[model samples]
Structure formats: structure tokens, C-alpha cells
Target: MRKVFLFIVLVAISMASYSQKRYENNYVSVVVPNGWVVQNKGDNGLGTELMSFYNDEYDANIYNFGMIIGFNQFQKPEFLLETQMNLKSSNPLFEKATFGKMYNSSFMGKSVKATDFKTQIFDETFKGTAYAFNEGGCTVLAVGSYKVGTKSDLPQIWRTVKWKNIRKDTHVYDSFREEIEAYCAATNKTLKQTPIVSNGERYVSVYLEPDANIITNTYKFVDMEKSSFDENKIEQIKQNLRPILLNILKATAKNAEIAAREMKEGYIFKYTYIDKNDEFLFSVKLTPDDYQ
Candidate 1:
């Protein structure tokens, strides 16, 4: 009877020791098994390391997991994925690694792009997987690595991650884009690219440009195959499109007032016309004086 009681106590203690605990930062939260240490490394250019965990007992065995949340540049999953893959491939340690096919999978309630890799390092086989996803203008990446034939809790750990809604301000570029898109849709004009807001300046592009029939508002593309247009022709095209571009600026002024006010000073707007190949044909600039 005493042996049975002792066995029951031992089982309960083991289960308690393996239980998980929640860890979180400003951007994300995740559950990790007990005895694992979590570290947060704030803002490393590429992204913010929200949480990274490793068990001291398995540290020598190469067992670990990390999650990063990115907002400044490389916010797209495809771009992030490419950058990560390139970094790994360039590392001398993973020179002979075999990367697996990329696929879409659901993790932490979001669709993610993921891939697996295997490499041999100093007679020890290492296996790893990476995942990326974009949410609310931020990209999140989760990676896990372990030595082959070793036990790993990464899969169970990542499945319990939850993203926090922490972005309080919308990007000014998004506002400019929305207003420009609405104006383009109303005017039956097609935009060549999304509006870009950088360094207190906004740039927009359209598919058509003013030609010889500028008086009639008839737009066409220049023959780039022949040769690039001369300086005189380029200047003339810019002059012809000036009024039309100004009108677009005026039309979106009310909607973009909030973004402009945020800039406070030195706000410039540029509209460019591009060819089918996305080559720049001509462009016009509107200063605060022109838009106000």
C-alpha cells in the first residue's frame, strides 16, 4: 500500500514539473515549459525579439525557440522569409544544409509560411523550422531548432503563442494610399503603384501620361523602345500634367489633412506617370504652397 502511495506522489510531482508557464512582452505572449528560461532582446533592426527560450539542461544539445515581431521594413512575409533563408544559407555552419519545400500552415490562429531544414554540424545532425506571418502591418517570425534524435517542446510551445494588439497608430502611408485609391477609382484612372510616404514626402504613380493631345486630356505612353524622351519632351509632359496632378492633390486634400498636419512642415507630394513596364515617363511635384 505504501509503495502505491509513493508511486502516485512521484507521478504527480513529475507532471507538475513539466507544466507550462505564460511569458509575454509588449507585443506577444507565449507558453513555455517549466525550467525553460525566456529572454527578450528589444529591437534588433530586423525586428524585436519578443521571446526566446531554452532549457539549461538541453542548451548543450542545441534545443531552442525564438519569436520576432517586425514593423520597420521587411514587413511582408515573403520578403522576411527570403531574408531569413538567405542568412541561414550564408552561414558557414549551415553550408551543407538541405532546405525543404515551403508551405502554408496555420499557427497561433494565423496562416503562416514555413519551411524546414536539416544540417550536419560536427557529426551532430541539427533540424530546424521557421515560420513567418504578417498581422496589423507587422511581421512575426518563429523559429525552432534542435539536435536530431533529441526531444523538443517547440511544436507544443509555439502552438500556445498569442499576438497582442499593440500598434496604436496607423502609418501615414496607409492614409495617403486610401485617399489616392479612392480618387483614382472615381476618375477611372489606374494606379501604377501604391502611394509611398517617406521622410515627410508622399509619392504616387499613374499608368498614363500627357502626350501631344494634352488639350483634350488624352493620355498615352511614350515609345521607350525607340529611345528615352529628350529633356524638352519630358519637361513639356510634366507641364501638361501639372493641372491634372494638382486636381488629384486637391481632391484628396480633405482626407489627407490629418496626415499632412502630422508632418507639420516640409511635406511634399509627387505624382509620376509610368509606362506599362513601370518605367517613369514623367513626374510633377506639389509643395505646401501648391496644395494648401
Candidate 2:
């Protein structure tokens, strides 16, 4: 217990000093798992290694994901919480015994709150820790850990990491979002009002809400769906003035029949059926020339 507490305090106090990347001047800088993609970096120009981080196995059960001691192969890390706990329990030098825990929490000195997560895997268990320590300056360490089969895995894991220079984390570009936007633009889709999405909803979504003279390829994730539109109304609506939609369908669409439906409000064209296979929007097109 005392040794674990001492380690936590030591990490919290931070003997070594560092700052986040420049762009992260205000936002807290977080060290992410090595294989996770980092699209952008800080304010200063930094080497790709210093500027971004990514992980190969996003679903891999990674723990004790330490910067100063990260394993390269990622197949199996050397350090295991159980080994440390067992060591402390058996070692005569240590006075008290406690769970394998070394925790330090701070909010990049801004006084925000973020909790750590811990999970048990297979025969071994692990604890994930994330906290900012404001020692010389505020620094954040995000940890993920796993269990090792034997004591032999530890030394090699520690030695493989080039911990001599632990550089500040960075993100270089908005690759993911940028790609999404480009695809939507090419397809004439628009983004929804809010950037954040509901769980189970499209993590990233575009909309196809069309305007009077233009087809909106903007998308709304199904997670955000409400009772606004019914099958009756949907069946009644047709693909119209969004000029872009015509372009998109030009390649695959074999044929289309345009017609008009009389309503108390007004007359509208419906693209009723298309292609010999019955793949189309409405019964007619809303163009006046096609009404006759």
C-alpha cells in the first residue's frame, strides 16, 4: 500500500517537466493509445512521431498503456498488475499490501473532472487510469493496462520502450471529418445541425434534405429520427429540384417516368417509378413541361 501510494504521489508530483502541444494551449492535452489515429497536432511544427499517435488494434485489450514503458509488438505487454500486486504482497521490504494501483489526478491545472476506468480480463485483471498531474506544469497521462502470464515478460517490455524522450502528444489533421465532408459535397449531402451524434446513431452522418430548387444530400442519422414523417407522406414525396440528385442517378438510373398529383395546396410532380425494376421515387416529375 505504501509503495503504491508513493508511486502515485511521485507521478502526481511529476519530477520531469513537459507541456502539451501548442494548439492544446487551452484544451487539455491527452496522451492517447499508440495505435489510435491522431489527425492534428499542436501549434508548433513537430515531427510526425512527436506530433501524432495511432494504434493498430483498436479492439485489442490494452492495459498499462504507459508512455515511458509501452511494448512495441502489442501482442503481449510485459507488465501485469497481478505481478506487481503479487510482488508487493510477497516482498518483505514493503509494509502494507493493497490492490495494484498507482493513481494521480489533475486537470491540466484547470480543475476539471475526469475519472479512470479499470477492467479485469481473463485470469488477470487491469485498471485503466486517466488524470492530469499539475506538478512543474500540468501534464496528462492516459493509461490502459493488461495482465502478463509470467514475470519474465516485464523486463523486455520495459526495455523495449525508448522512454528517454517522452514527447508531448499531437494531432496533425482532421482526416476523418474532412473525408466525410468531401464525400458529402461530391454527393450533394449536407451535415446535420449538431456535430455530436447519439449513440447507435451514425457516428458521422450527412443529410439529404432537399430545397425547392436543389436536392440536399444532407443526411440525418436514424438515431435522431422522430415521429415527424410517416410512410404516407414519404410515399407521397418525390425527387425534385435538387439538381445534384439527377447527376448522382445518371449513371445507374436506366429510365424514369414523371407525373403530377393534384392537391388542394398545389400541383407537384412525382417521380413515381423508375428503372424496369421499380427503383424510383414518385409517380411523376414536378416539371411543368412533363405535366401534359
- Candidate 2 lDDT (Cα, whole model)? 0.28
User: How well does candidate 2 match the true structure in TM-score terms?
Assistant: 0.24
TM-scores for every predicted model: 0.46, 0.24
Q: How accurate is candidate 1 locally (lDDT)?
A: 0.52
Instruction: Give residue 247's error in model 2 in angstroms.
Output: 37
lDDT scores in order: 0.52, 0.28
Misplaced by over 4 Å in model 1 are 1-20, 44-47, 57-60, 72-74, 89-97, 120-123, 166-292
- Residue-level error in angstroms, candidate 1, position 101: 2.6
Q: Looking at model 2, which ten-residue stretch has the lowest summed lDDT?
A: 69-78
How large is the C-alpha RMSD of every model relative to the true structure?
Answer: 17.2, 20.2
